[model samples]
Target: MSGAETEPGVLVLAATPIGRVADAPPRLAEELADADVVAAEDTRRLKRLTGELGVEVTGRVVSYFEGNEQRRTPALLGSLLAGERVLLVTDAGMPSVSDPGYRLVAAAVEAGVPVTAVPGPSAVLTALAVSGLPVDRFCFEGFLPRKAGERARRLAELASERRTMVFFEAPHRTEAALEAMAQAWGGERPAAVCRELTKTHEEVRRGPLAELVAWAADGVRGEVTLVVQGADDVPAVSTDDSSLRAAVAEREDRGMTRKEAIAEVAVLAGVPKREVYDLVHKSGPGEATP
Candidate 1:
């Protein structure tokens, strides 16, 4: 076997700046200049970024995006097996983060090729840092479903997620997304809507989810990153008959129907719906039932 064939290749996952060109790291430029092959989500955008940085890519360039990732994986793997240093980059942020590059990484791992990263700017971290919310423990939820029902169902599934959550959203859908979040996680949930982060016209709007919904209704522009506070760890109330009645009464006061109140109270109390229903009925007007 030739020397190149005997040697294992390296896969470098390079992170590009989300907005500001200056955020691109020195190592990123070095990788782009020296790699045997550069697989980018958008070769045009990659060219533009390199121009802005005044760096010349000496390596062969190829497209590696969602549309062509599957067909391109094997060829990229072939390069790696041939001991070619393959560099991966996406249009923005880190690769494999709501972007392509994951499949290539998986393939490289399986083939026993060495893999490393040249971490740089990230929309997720940039938004979280500027959001002013608790970031000590957080989760990155890339993007919500495009359809209304699917989106709502996804939000509902995360209604009780206790970790601070971050999400990327298109400018056009910001208003609808905020509105849905308000409905699922309660209107009063604290959140921040970061727009055009790290670039000119960057704006970070922080407030209750309901207020943000109204703000977005007026319309918003630019890429958006949403940071939401986790569910409050409310102490579990007693599940006794009196507690169930109180819970039901609270929901009723909030405009819920009696049937709706009973169902919600059962969920909160971790009891059967029938038990809550019987308790609500047994407690007659002004009748104290413990």
Candidate 2:
């Protein structure tokens, strides 16, 4: 008996090169030639890719994109169950990464099928690596809401996010998105706009949010990945007698009662409420009262 006939079927998730055909890994070609079924986000693109790499897929090729992923998952799962090697490749990058393939992976996992990957190029990491921003701790925000109000609200929520943030934006909406980001994250926040990464005409623009907004005003082109620096760490406030009293007074003026003001001030200044209360009391009635 052959190993392919005896071993359990496997689901292989392959990552296609985002750009630059030479980036395709060897394992990708090997699996393409050996798999029983090849599911691609775009079969036409897959054909071109195979031609460019001088590799031929012996497996049956089928479309597995956003529109038909759910409908096609069952059949693909059946292939895996029948001891057939099924390979899943997206148009670019890894499957289920702000792209199709999540549903199929989840289904495969639930069915006890062996799922593995052929790791390759990614636009997210590629942009971050060359973004000239902090990469140690970062978050991928995928794509923001397309509507103006929803997008604004979303940006507002991330205004204070401390980890460097990465986002994907359409070329046409790049200017509008940057303007909104500038409004929510402050004009001076540092960021990098990477366009057409890993391809000819690739451009990376790094500057304050406002500057990028201005640069994109006239127009911009190509696939865009925005990497924005996180919010600056808030400086610790001195908990001296005067500073504490001033903090409490400031909150009190903003409509907080003396007791409420002291507690809030203590939290902000990283001191005890009792300490803030004592400072407020020591300032005398004139300065303590809002």
Candidate 3:
């Protein structure tokens, strides 16, 4: 192997401030000013952040967002292989949580490149900390499905998740998303909706899911992160024929072929695939699915 290949450059995943500019770590400026290349989700946002930090990025800056992450991974990997320090920063929070950099990071690791991070602020952790929910054991579920049926199914799959859950949602969809959560998890479930965290107009609404849904009905704005209470008691995995059939039907309704839906439903519910197929067809009278 060539020396450059063996001594591949470092990939620094820097966490930019999710809200307040002061939340950016001191090393973030140093790394931004020193790296050979800086890949940003939004170059304009990076420029604003750098200005706020009173630091200038001396490296080459390139756009690296969802649209071009796949197309650009190889080029960034080349820079890493060529022994250049490449720093990656997203618009807010860490990269790859629900952003770009996963592909590049994975490629760099495959090429034996050194990968490091400048951990700072995170919306997931920030919301969780102030959520007043159980933080001892929690899970980041990212964003939920946008479509209603798909969203309901996704929530169903996580119905038994015992760990506190965190989810990101768009400002416009906040009300609808909360309404779905109320329907799936019950109206009384406790949750918190953190909006524009750490910013001047930041607000954290804590209450029952039902109440949140009602409050959001008027409309919500800014970036949103929800912290929800997990099931206090893990419910029994539904094995009833009616429950199983309904589960299969939902997936099929979402465009999955019947066979595909059965298999998926079986795996998701931990039931035998054959059973789902059989019971789904064993309707007595008006139980036909159409």
* TM-score for each candidate, following the candidate numbering: 0.81, 0.79, 0.87
Candidate 3 stretches with Cα past 4 Å from truth are: 1-6, 237-273, 281-290
In the range 1-290, model 2's lDDT, one tens digit per residue, is 64544455899999999879999998888988898999999999999998988888998999999999899999888888788999999888898999888888898899888999999999999999999899999999999999987787677556547899999999999999999988777799999999988899989999999999999988999989999999887445577878777766654544345776676567768888787777767677567543
Sort by TM-score, best first. 3, 1, 2
- Expressed as tens digits, the lDDT of each residue in 1-290 for candidate 1 is 64534677899999999888988998998999999999999999999999998889998999999999999999999999988999999999899999998999999999999999998999998889888989889999989999987787677666657889999999999999999989877999999999999889999999999999999998999989999999987345479877878877765544446776677668767888999888878898794333
**Best model per TM-score:** 3
Ranking according to lDDT, highest score first: 3, 1, 2
What is the lDDT for 37 in model 1? 97
Q: How many clashing residue pairs, candidate 1?
A: 0
Give the per-residue lDDT digits (tens) of candidate 3, residues 1-290.
Answer: 64532578899999999889989999999999999999999999999999989998889999999999999999999999888999999999999889998999899988889999999999999999999999999999999999987787777666657899999999998998898888877899999999999999999999999999989989998999999999887533378888888876765554456676677678767888888878978867776443
